[model samples]
Target chain A: MEANIAVSSEKKPTWGGGGVRPFGASYGKMMMWFFIVSDALTFSGFLAAYGLTRFKFIDSWPIADEVFTHIPFIHGEFPMYYVAFMTFILIFSSVTMVLAVDAGHKMNKKKVTWYLFATIIGGLIFVGSQAWEWKTFIKGSYGAVKTTDGKILQFVNESGKQIALSDFVVGDRGDDKVTQTRKNGLWFESGESVGQYSVAQVISSYNANPSIQIRSEKIDLDTKQKIILSREKGAAELAKAKLVVEGANLEVNEYGNTIFADFFFFITGFHGFHVFSGIVINIIIFFNVILGTYERRGHYEMVEKVGLYWHFVDLVWVFVFTFFYLV
Target chain B: MAHAHDNSNVKRIWMVFGLLSVVTIVEVALGIVKPDFLHLNGIGTSWLNWIFIILTLVKAYYITWTFMHMEGEKTWFRRAVVWTAVFLIIYLVTLLLIEGGYLFETLAPLVRW
Candidate 1:
């Protein structure tokens, strides 16, 4: 019976090896599906690890809504709406990608080109939007004061609005004065990278004015966070300060927390990397399509394969949207 | 050169896409508003979380079955792929929770510090 089955399979034209030929799909397409599944699993593992860490630090975890509130070309804080637009872009890209595949099936070159171009533009816009998001994240909003005990105490106005250190950091320093290097004071400087301005500088500048009082990194350094005093006293005490806002656990971030920043960089960076690769692949395929390579061959299976990949990107974004934005 | 999709099927695909987008908007609204009843603060084990998970699963199901055309495949083939993912996800989540709970308890002191 096994020999009979083997003989029967041998009668069919197997494009590639493996007796596990899927119905109505070439070996490449089958492999692509398998590859997509494995990739999906890998992404799931990373996201699950993210979930685990977030759950562990549930109380201290940064608020997603607050952090990702900014919109492109808009000044005010609008939570989730911008990301919603990004989601629409990706979903629309997926639609265009599928439409291209559909056009490919009918062998309509013009329609395929139009749809593919739309998809590519959509992807580019998404990448650009992501870059803007990263810029906003890196710049940070408000700074906090880190205490000797490694605790962070943030400053807020009477209305509980986060006051950016820059709001009070008044100085006329050159670009060289404000840089993010590895070391300015530490001689060891093995990394030998540029360093960001010391938090001390921000505090000193803030203390320069009389209206603002020195708030210790420790909320209970003396008694309350609000210190009442004149300019001379605030500046005098701020000069002797040893600690500053290295990082914090509030909505108003300073260079953001390393973990949050790292995750943001890593996850979005990885996704962006995928988009880059997809664009390269798309470009190659675009050239091929223009050359009428598949058209001459009388099959647009290549287009279909790439469409599957493009849609996979879209599908991943849907989940990323949920996990990173909504959740 | 092949004409696999008829005009009727094309229209159907667009209809499905519209439906999917509508469902997504609904999910987003639910997520954004985070209704009082859906608020998991005092609830047991977070019904909102469960709702979100279920909705996510539904979306995944639609995407896979309809968009990916997995529903058109052979019964055993579909089962093999879907069931493998389902079983593995279940196993992974279980192991993760168990190990995570253990680690959380063990590292509680260090964490507090």
Candidate 2:
């Protein structure tokens, strides 16, 4: 064994010995890999918690299709269409990133610059799309009533198509309840923005509209749809209304379980923050490339390192797209 | 850094992009249609879910191997990075999912269906 070790040592110096590259990978790249692995575990933890909560509340969980059914520019229900477009944009940006790295390897400055430009544009569009999605989610399409027991009751027609609050609700809210902002109220205290409608108005409106039926948050396993109540049952359920919920927030969600919206915001917000920072880093690296920093160094290893990070962001989005939208 | 002449593999890069795009299209199509046969039956999840998970893995493999240039990486580097993640993520998912199932069973009676 000592003879063999001596022979191996005489042959050539191995990596991780006196500033040698380990695993044929540079120090920067290996550190980046370590970051990616730890980040992956963090994401996995979040997803696993989501899975556990979803399973625990399987019966009352919101259906993905029903909640995410909005498309920009168009008004009708187009579930997952915009989300798919966002996914394509992100993936396409990743392609451009790899292309940029390839150009870097070839020392083709012009191609690298242009590809990097394309990638930055793609990232901008994706971040914008995510913002728009968040806006749409916050401004819910079909408003619902929150009962005293913390249950959600949405309205639907006989055909089971969800009807917006504007479709049937008709009455003026007599109570003068304005939004309590920090500036308007005590400087040290504030409250959530007031909803568009009030519980009293909604209750009166529901009492007037006999055609509108109530749909509870609970899903019928056999039908794979939320349980819609009869007209009499609808009125009885509406009588328990404690507040009017127009959109989503940290506390209340018109879609279904409040925890769903909580996780949605936390996970996607964290991911979005990553994408945003990735763009900033890319821009810096893009400028460095334009200034011939890597070219002067006679290697584009910096570009390759950043490419790994960019691709990792894209990779995380793939799983996010599946879990949040597709599933 | 040495293989400057062979650095630009434009054709292979585009081919990988095409493959990823096609796979994404297939995933979206399947998700939208949600064929009844695939959605209704499975061991734990539906066959559709299994298909999605499998296709996602395929996409992940291609991205890591081709775009990330893991294909050209040394064997130990590849194993150190990929194998560690694969094993840990699977283990985490399995334990979490099993615990979640147990929670569901325990709380099934309390929650109104």
Candidate 3:
């Protein structure tokens, strides 16, 4: 008991002197690491949930190549090319950030400033590209029908190439029916905006076209391609379509499964938000570097810290790119 | 941190960047081509998927070790950060995927197409 009392008394002074540094790391840096680890776990939870749900609907999941094929101002089907470009931009930004941190270590404010500026530009480009990608995805390339049983049926040519609704869906929509608003209809609140073509228009147009066949979402294990229905069966299935889906939303997706879009929006949006914040933080640090605050302090630890965060964001994108685009 | 400001360190950074870029290029090429041999099922997934996952891990390692300066940190600090995340992530992914597979089996008869 006396020894225990002595040990406790001896430990009090060290405890009062602002706790021990675990592994010689500063308090702020350690706290940042703790936050990062927890944040990483949260991301992992989301991705794991994505993996599980994807596994559950593996048979009907959208092909990543077909879904993410658009590039800005380009009309060709270049699968995974634009996404690879985005990944390279992010990784390059990470490189610039590390260079800035290295420059900061040598007290080279000029070098640090230039590198920081480059990093910020890279980040802005990446964010802009992401927005464009989102717009393309939401706008959709080909229109598909959602059956009453919640299955998506896409249109394809006899050659097995995908066909846009505009290719065969002829005739103008006669009515300009807008979504019902609260003021327009009693007890009705507007939700999402209406799609381009109505179900009736799509059905009639599909029936008029003989070359168009229905492609089911289920992939044939042998061919690794979606199963295409016969012309007669395609017409029969088109009769079961309840709604005309042109693009993706939280509720409906013209792309194979609704859950796939849900995960795509949630995961990529969350990562984009991180990149946005990292740019904001980098801007703040860039100003501090210019103001010579770190010069007076004799160290540019602020740059180093922010570099840590920026690198972390890049790391997460690597995984997101792999799972979402490549896989 | 002080020694990392040297010219060789800059070259090292660029080299790591090259390595990461090469890995990404390889991943993209494989994804685009999807070689017949690589597409064969192995264990639970295709060998191609396993290759992508492994390459992703390699990229993650370079980003953390070089860019984040984990190599400069003390041993315990590095372990504390890396080990915790690695173990927990592996555990979570394994169990969840198993559950997902089971759910697919249960729902197989009910769902159409």
Clashes of each: 10, 0, 0
Query: Which candidate tops DockQ?
Result: 3
lDDT of 1: 0.65
Q: Which sections of candidate 1 miss by over 4 Å?
A: A1-20, A148-152, A168-257, B1-5, B40-45, B106-113
Clashing pairs for model 3 are none
Q: What residue pairs are clashing in model 2?
A: none
Residue-wise C-alpha lDDT for candidate 2, range A209-312, written one tens digit per residue = 77889999887766667899888887887898998888898998999999999999988998999999999999999999999998998978888888998888
Q: After superposition, how far is residue A1 of candidate 1 from its true place, in Å?
A: 22
Docking quality of model 1: it rates as acceptable
Provide the DockQ value for model 1.
Answer: 0.25
The order of the candidates by DockQ, greatest first, is 3, 2, 1
Give residue A3's error in model 1 in angstroms: 12
Go through the candidates in order and give each one's C-alpha lDDT: 0.65, 0.85, 0.89
- DockQ list for all candidates: 0.25, 0.59, 0.77
Index of the highest-lDDT prediction:
3
Could you tell me the lDDT of residue A115 within candidate 2?
A: 96
Q: Would you give the TM-score of chain B in model 3?
A: 0.93
lDDT of 1 by residue, A1-327 (tens): 456454455555544644455675667777777777777777777677676665554444555665677887778777777787887787777777777877888888888888888888888999999888887776655665544434344444444455666666665432454434545564453453333445556565665554555433221212212333345554554455444443322332343233665666777777887787787788788888888998998977788888778777777777777777666
